[model samples]
Target: MCGITGFVDFTPASEEREVLIDTMTATMHRRGPDDQRTWLDRHVALGVRRLSVVDLVGGVQPMVAQRPGEPPVTLAYTGEVFNCDELRAELRSHGHTFTTSSDTEVVLASYLQWGAACAERLLGMFAFAVWDGRTDEVHLIRDRFGIYPMYYTEVPGGFVFGSALMALLKHPAVEPVVDTEGLRAIVDFVKAPENGIFAGVKEVRGGTIVRFGRNGLSVTTYWAPPARPHEDDLDTTVGTVRELLEDSVRRQLHSDVPLGVFLSGGLDSSALLALAARHNGGETLRTYSIDFAGHDKNFTPDEVRSTPDYPFVARMVEHLGTDHTRVVVSPEELMDPEVRREVLLARDIPTSLGDLDTSYLLLARRFRQDCTVALGGEGADELFGGYHWFLEDRFVDAQALPWLEFGRQMAGKNGLRNTGLINQDLVESLGSDEAERDLYATEVAKIERLPGESDVDRKIRTVTYLNLTGYLRIILDRKDRIGMAVSLEGRVPFLDHRLVEYVYNVPWAMKSFDGREKSLLRAAVRDLLPPSVLYRKKAGYPPIDDPGYDRALRAMVTELLADGSAPIQPFLDLGTAKSYLADPTSAASREKVNRFSLEMVLYLNEWLATYDARLAI
Candidate 1:
């Protein structure tokens, strides 16, 4: 994994523009700490930071590919292309000879052989830019699932894009401004498609290509999971899922450096670890888990997380007999200002689950000490119906995105703290409710219902689509940003396009055939995992449950409130803010609702100050 950033210039390049590109690329140095390179042309300049996962010495970029008497194509790429060897062989047969063993070369060569359609032939989590000198155009492409992020902003001469928003913000022409809709997106959890949250900046939708030329830029969808009728029965679906998972794990294990698994002992991660171990045969695959200090003694069952992860993690670790390390974080570590600031900077957004994200960052940073890549279980929930919303009719049948429904329900229970505290008139003006409805409605409208499908099946398909495109993107982005922040490449075998496509068309009856969550998945991997893990109810990553952490948050928020000149104060209700700050660390104030409010205020303040954001709202 690496970072790619560049811009297509309608105007000629100069020394100043080169400096701007250098600054933009420097912001992503942590993403590609191994090597840094830039390629400049009269109308385009491309930059990349290399983590050196594949073709360590020869895979340098921005790589240029050409043939005799033909204009050259320069490629600035990130992420691994799992099938690059296959693509390379195919290109070789077509008289394209490679000078290097890097997939970066394959990407450039593939484009030379097949044009922009080459993106459809490649498979992996990638965000790349191809400058085709033949046509004097640049093509920006992201993986089908949007596992890699690509943010772009239209500027005076042309457009600028990068793997992260910070890179684009490094450009002098880009503004750190947010409008009403952007603010609503910040507070709300809706993963609006193509929404970048910054004024005039847009994220390239996954599975698509954006081409910039003399006629300006045009977007095209090169790939998407096809909607088709399911012909396979339950037994076949289970077998196929197992087969695809095995293949995905085997393919993803092609890292040159040491790799490990993020094991929580839940069905998803447990199954992935078992498969990875199976691929290794005799070798014990290293595994890692995250836990809170004193969690075993102070653990409390919650609606989302029933039991602590340590027990399940222990069982899996002991059963697998692999080299394992447990990262136990104390409340102090979770609430550390420096840790929180790193998390904020990594996400480049004010996420509601601040502590959990920070913990993941710590875990990732730790993993980097021993491994450059780690396989994580992320896309399984969206594809396998593992979330609570999948089992409940209310959320499944809700007209909005099911997770947003879950969020609202949690907000009602003080799960989303910032709900009523913010400016209601502003929230309403941003059409928070209507925005979610319209987005969900648009996604639902795009679902291609199968012939003779029942209402329940149709509903399941709609929810599945939203989960795959919306919820899964959130998880993927979180993992990418947090993991890449430490220069660790996080691979999701569960997100391999084949697995997602296969499971997406599976009938709802078959998915929940056993009247349990991820029934098909459980059946597929039950042979490898113990019954305890196989039957473990769905549990998300544990949050900071220590009251000491709450107290720390209160102190921080209180300090911010005391600073009347704080950037966020203008948007906050003083009385409400002070009231929450008064005793926000109490046990009664531990709900996600209160915590979200506290975290959001702090994040908003920091974000406004860090970016010097101009909020048009």
Candidate 2:
């Protein structure tokens, strides 16, 4: 894992290029604390901050490959390619000699052997930029599922690209600006594909390749979930899922540094831990979970999260007999202004899930102390039907994104709306409602339907596609950014493209065969987990329910409203915010609605001030 940044400019000065690239690379110090390097030429500059996960001593960047009488091809890469060994063996047979055992070298070799088509052959989570001097072109590629992020924008002579938005923002050519479309994306939860949330900057969509050359920039999608007939019986399909999942987990276990699993005791994480334990040849595996300091006592059941993870976590720990540690975070830590600032910086935008983001950031920080790489269970919920919206009829039949509709319904129960606190005039001016409808239509149109498919089947597939492409992107981004922020690499075995493709085409009836959330997943791993965990209901990532955290948010919002120079004040409805703050309800009693509103106000203010973000609208 690493942080990569660079540019391809026709007009370049060597000294200035080095300084500029160095500055951009420095912003990602947290992503790669092990090593930093820069490579420069007249027309291109490449930089990387290395975490040294695989081939600790041998892997270094920006790595270059050259053949006599030919210009060198330099690669600044991030994320891991699990099929590196296989690709390396194949490349060797083609007379390619390698000096290092690094997957970075294997990626460069793949590019050399297949040119731009190399992205199609890769099987891992990655976003890499390859500068091919031979073709005088730079190719930016992201994994099929976009587990790794890549952002870029066109410059005067060429273009600049990076692993994170901050890297691109640090460049002199880019400005800290958020236009109307960007603002819409922030307020709306449906993340449009390739929307970078900054004017002129575009994210390299997953399963895509962006090539910049003399002719100009071009994008080609190398992969998407292809719709096909499902001919296998229920038993055969279950067996196939198990086989693909096991292969993915085994492939991701190849890491040089200490590795572990993020165990939430939920179906996703527990299943991964079970597989990891089985594959380790009886070697003890380290697992970790996160919880609030007083969660067990203060925890209140809601529609989303019904139970505390600790009980199930304990069961898994004892069942697997694996070494486990639970990181307990206090309300004070979650409410710390400095911690919030770091979370905002890590995300590069304000998120509505306040404590959810902070808790993950804190957990990643602690995880980094012991392990460089940790396997997670992220894509399982989206691939299998795990969310409440997937099971409930009202949500399933909703015309909009099922998750968005579910969010609205949940908030409505508290007499609140997702964006209720925002300025009404601003929302209309930004066309938030229209943008969401358009986005939904655009996404739904992208789903390839099977011939003779029933309306119910098509609707199910549409919802599944939306979740995989839209909601899953948010989950992956959060996991990647938070983990990378602490120099901890998070590997998601469930996100393997092979697994995603196979499961995506399975009929919904078979997916929910047992009439429960994640039925297919539970059936596949039934023997691996205790019934206590395998039968547990779907619970969202835990958030601190302590009133102290809510009190802190109220205090921060109060301070923001009082400050005459606060940037977010212009976009907020102060009267509504002040009324909410003045309400007599106890913080814990009114936690759901109040906490979300206050978090948005506080996070937006911090983001604007820290990033010097100007709202162009």
Candidate 3:
């Protein structure tokens, strides 16, 4: 894992380029604290901060490879290539020699052999920039599922790219500006594909390659979930899922540094822990879970999260007999201003998820104390129909994004408004409702329906596609930002493209054969896990429900409203904001609605001030 940034400009002097690249790279020091390196030429400069996961001693960047009489090719890479050994063996047979066992070297060698088509052959989470001195072109590639992040924008003479938005924002050519479209996406939480939420910057779409040369720029999607008929029976499909999942977990276990599993005791995570334990031979695998200081005793069941994770976590720990640690965090920690600032910086954008994002950041920080790489279960829910909304008929039939609709309904039931406290005039001008409808229609049109498919199957397929491409992307981005912020590499075995493709085509009926969430996943590992975990109902990551957290958020909102110079003040609906603040115990201040609204205001305030972001609305 690493943080990579660079620029291709014909104008900057080499010394000036180096200084700029260094500054951009330094912005991601938390991502790669192990080593930092820079490579420069007259027209381009590349920088990387390395975490040293695979080949600690030999994997260094920016790594350059050259053949006699051929232009040298340099790679500033991040994320691991799980199929490195296989690719290495194949490359070696083609007369490629290597001095190191690093996957970084394998990637460069593959690029040398296949040119731009090399991205299609890689099988891991990655976003990298390869400067082919041969053609003076740079190719930026992201994994099929976009488990890692890459952002870029065009410059005067050429372009600039980085592993994170913060890195790109540090470059002099980029500005912290959000246009109407960007603001709409942020406020409505309708993330358009490739929209970076910054005016000029664009996120490299997953499964695509962006090539920049003297001919300007081009993008080609090398991978997508292809529409295909499933011929396998229920038993065969179940067996295939198990095989693919096991292989993915095995490949990801090749890290050189200490690794662990994020165990939520839910089926998805418990399944991963079971597999990792089985593959550990005789060693005791390390597993970690996060909990609030008194959440277990004070736990309140909500519409989404029902049952605390600690009880299930304890069951898994004892069942697996692994070294498990439950990191308890206090509401004070969750409400800390400094911690909130760190979370905002890590995300490089404002979020309304509040403690959900902060808790993960804090967990990742603690995980980094003992592990460099940790396997997580992120894509399983999207792939296997695990969310509560997936089972509800109303959400399944909704024309809008199901999760967004669910959030709206949930908030409405609490006598509160979803997306509350934003300036009503700004929301109307952005046409957020129409924009969401258009976005939904655009995405739905892209789904390739099977010939003669049933109407029910078609609707389910569309919902699955939307969740995989939209909701899953947000989840993966959160996981990457928080984990990388602490220099901890998170590997999602469930997101292996091979697994995603296979399961994507599986009929929904078979996916929920047992009439349960993640039914397929549960059956695939039924024998590996205890029934207590394998049959457990779907539960989300626990939220901080302590009343103290709510008080802190209300206090912050009060302060923001009083401050005359607050940047977010212009965008706030003062009447609505003050109404919620007026009575903390009112229905308007219910934990779910109040936390979300307050979080948006607080996070947006911090982001606007810290990034000097000008709202061009």
Candidate 4:
């Protein structure tokens, strides 16, 4: 919902330091175009770019609270604490009077009341910094789901933290250095916790607090998916899941600004729309969906995406009688250089899925024109065993992470991105396969299995954990980065900590009780949705099937071949790159490997030049 950047300097503060903080905040201008402000003290400097979602006129920051005798507590926060009204009431009862009707003040008072443990009592997707002038320390907290991103780097005097990696890179104290581990992380697609992809930088893990001050930094994990025994029957579990979901949707709908729901007509999105509509009562419900220009006419089934989204979206729109708008993107828009660059800027890294990432950015930007907040259906697949890999026998039995196994399957079919495209020497040096193996093992070891669990149950639980902890982060990060790029606040009720925890411990058997994906979710909201939508096979966000997009990508990558000094040349195998680009008119779904390879080459070259990145390896 907003962008936050700040620093704590153990050394003396100078005019240059203040300017650096300003520059850092400036990088996230698009994230918070509504307003900008800065706060400075002897050792701490905080900045915020606000989007003005709730209490728009009142919740301006960096908000500083000073009690009669206590040091001023300054807060630079990003995100809507969905439970603000309740928290404000409780804090008010405890003698905390609010001057502004804003959640930001409630958060500051919460810190004043509970100290570092304040993070434990909050609910919502947020990444914030609470500067306690009393203790001369700052507490950095990310939500339980890590929905909002917070990256930090330790500098000479103290540290620099920001909402995006680019925000941190804007400071002169940081450099674009990718070490071997960072490269491995980029290639492997396994989002290891706190793996920031740059040397000397780390992300604050979800449900954790990082305390930094003159004493140095300490991290404490306040929440995680607890491995608990299943204590309820199928019906009770279903009822409980439905109850939690309704509560989450009701809470998330507490937005003062105009809001909408993304309607893909998939189970997750439809259910969210249904629940949100119910919460809206008789009020008008605005909805939006995205699709390619000729998607329905040119639809092609694939392992990842089977059907087009437009038809299903139409059904939901008509069924719900909601005001709906469909944004149909053409191939040219998908291949536009400026648009692609903005997408790359949103995510300060070479994204793995090129069109998937850029399309959402474009759609979010369009949606921002009408509304500031949009509730989306993410985290459901991971939480409810909705991915196809969860049902595949090979992946279910594979000792590795199921998603990794799925990637291997894609590679075997010559469909995986970057397959047969990268330099073999780089692969050997990074040892990506081995690194991935180790990472999978580390993640698996973290899953605490229940006593007397069956082997089948154990394997399913492991896959569930991997998806929630690993794959879920990647999706959520994309959602946050792209959504914030346009100042669009994206809320995911499926990711509410309580819901995730409850479904996490439910046995996979019940999750797929009807021999279908997301059976539990389908059953929970069956009455609210049409059968066509309620039982529709899951489909991913559709990719542009137009061959023109592939041709455009090839033209861009071919230019790289002519320019031998291209930044990505050192990382590419010239022969393979040339071979892939020879016939570049096939759609990505038909020729995934070649299309993705060319897209990656262009993105990699641009990313290197954009950041002037250095490869230590």
Q: Which ten residues in a row have the lowest lDDT in candidate 4?
A: 583-592
The C-alpha local distance difference test score for the whole of candidate 4 amounts to 0.84
lDDT (tens digit, per residue) of candidate 2 on 470-555 = 88998998998888888899999998888998999888899999888888899999999999999999888887878778788778
Question: What's each prediction's clash count?
Answer: 5, 0, 0, 0
User: What are the Cα lDDT values of the candidates?
Assistant: 0.84, 0.87, 0.87, 0.84
What lDDT would candidate 1 get against the real structure? 0.84
Q: Compare candidates 2 and 4 on TM-score and give the better one.
A: 2
- Per-candidate TM vs. native? 0.97, 0.97, 0.97, 0.96
Model 3: per-residue lDDT, tens digit, 261-344?
999989999999898887877789888999998786778887777788988999999998988878899988988888888899
Model with the higher TM-score, candidate 3 or 4: 3
Q: Over the full model, what C-alpha lDDT does candidate 3 score relative to the true structure? A: 0.87
**lDDT, residue 591, model 3:** 37
- After superposing candidate 1 on the true structure, give the runs of residues whose Cα lies further than 4 Å from its correct spot: 411-414, 583-593
Displacement of residue 613 (Cα, Å) in model 4 is: 1.0
Q: How much does candidate 3 score in TM-score?
A: 0.97
Model 4 regions lying over 4 Å from their true place: 411-414, 583-592
lDDT of 4 by residue, 260-347 (tens): 9998989999999999989996898999988888776767678877777877889998988999888888888888889889888888
